[model samples]
Target: MHGTETIPVRRVRDGALDLLKWLALLSMVLDHLRYVGLSLDGLYVPGRLAFPWFCLAIAANLQRVRGAPVTGQWRYLGWLLLFSVISEVPYRLFIEDADTLNVLPTLALGLLVARGWQQKTLFDRGLALIALLLAALFSSNLMFGFFGVLLPLAMLLVFSRPWYFSVLPGLVCVAANQWQVLLDSGNLVALLGLATCLIAPLAGRVLLRYAQGASPPAMRRWAYALYPLHFLLLLLVRQIIA
Candidate 1:
């Protein structure tokens, strides 16, 4: 008892955070809808908000527990790893000529990087190093790649700071979205898409910070299944309608 450490204050759950999760999920669904053969290229712009928002959620979670004891850290990483495998087939089936694994892997690695930055223990730092090495080595085959893996850390860095700090991750979000592909397209929508990516983190932070009042369904571990399930459902709908 002589050496016991004081536990930091645990923040209450924010309804706005839940709202952000739902919005991120909807953005993801909207982004995927483009593959539904609807010629909805415009959906790609709003979809740009999805990954950054998700990363922001990760940052908010880590930020909430800063200096507090981390519970279920392994379990959190386990779910991401498990779903990364589970989601791959559905992801490939939905996106033709899919060049990368599903986005969960990127999120999974990003979680490690952000966690490492937060915890800073020898073990966590080692794990973070491994996550970065994997990201660097497999950038081409991972959805969003190395930059995506870093976005969570970037968001975490600015989680408690003023809004301008969101710009750090905003640029990372754009890079992860593959700006080169957008620029090559040479369309007004493509240009707008770049702006959308650059603004997504700031917009999401604003929502998390100021938006309130609506109680959304708590997104639990069960939501991990939704990533793969959505793709399967979309594939089914595509076959039925197309």
Candidate 2:
């Protein structure tokens, strides 16, 4: 009991976060479908929405810890860390030429950074600093690189500020992707993908504010399994069609 704290339970459900999770999951699947032997390159644009939305959801969960115990925070980090490892095999099997690791590690590190900022404790700060340094050092090997690590921190900064300030982080989100190269290519789909990356976080913020009252399916701990399982399911589909 000396070093442990009780994690506070939420009394009300946040439909917005649930909806965002579902949307992010859908976007990810759509993006991956392009590889399942179909002409679904068009899915790329919607897929741009996935990462940003997931980042926002992470921020939202961290935001709820204001003035509360950081008890459950460890579990949150643990779950991400576990799935990050669990998801690697399936992710590699599904995405050909995936030189980088899966996206979950980035999210896990980002969570630590956000918690470090919010908690402002020595341990938290040290952990966040280490994560930041590691992300910077291995930017090429990480899924979203340094910008991905920073996105969650940016979202945390935007969470409590004026709504209009979401644009700053939105820019960071877009930069996380290859927007400049896409613009240089002058491809319509790439251009749209860039726009979606820029807009995804802003759209998620709007939903969090205006759709708070809506009742959506809650994405609980069980949802962690979805990350790896989806890849396997798609792989089966790919094998079947082949």
Q: What are the RMSDs of all candidates, in order?
A: 3.5, 4.2
Give per-residue CA lDDT, model 2, range 1-242, as digits (tens): 65688877656878878888898999999999999998888899999988988999989998886677887889999999999999999999999789899999999988888888989989999999999999999999988789999999999898878878988888988888866788898888999998888778788898888887878788999999999999999999999998
Candidate 1 structure quality by residue, lDDT tens digits, 1-242: 45688777765668888899899999999989999988998998888889999999988888776766777667888999999999998999999889899999999999999999999899999999999999999999999989999999999998889889878999999899889999998898898989999999999988987787768888888999999999999999899889
Tell me the lDDT of candidate 2: 0.89
- The collision pairs in model 1 are none
lDDT of each: 0.90, 0.89
| Top candidate (TM-score) | 2
Model 1 earns a TM-score of: 0.93
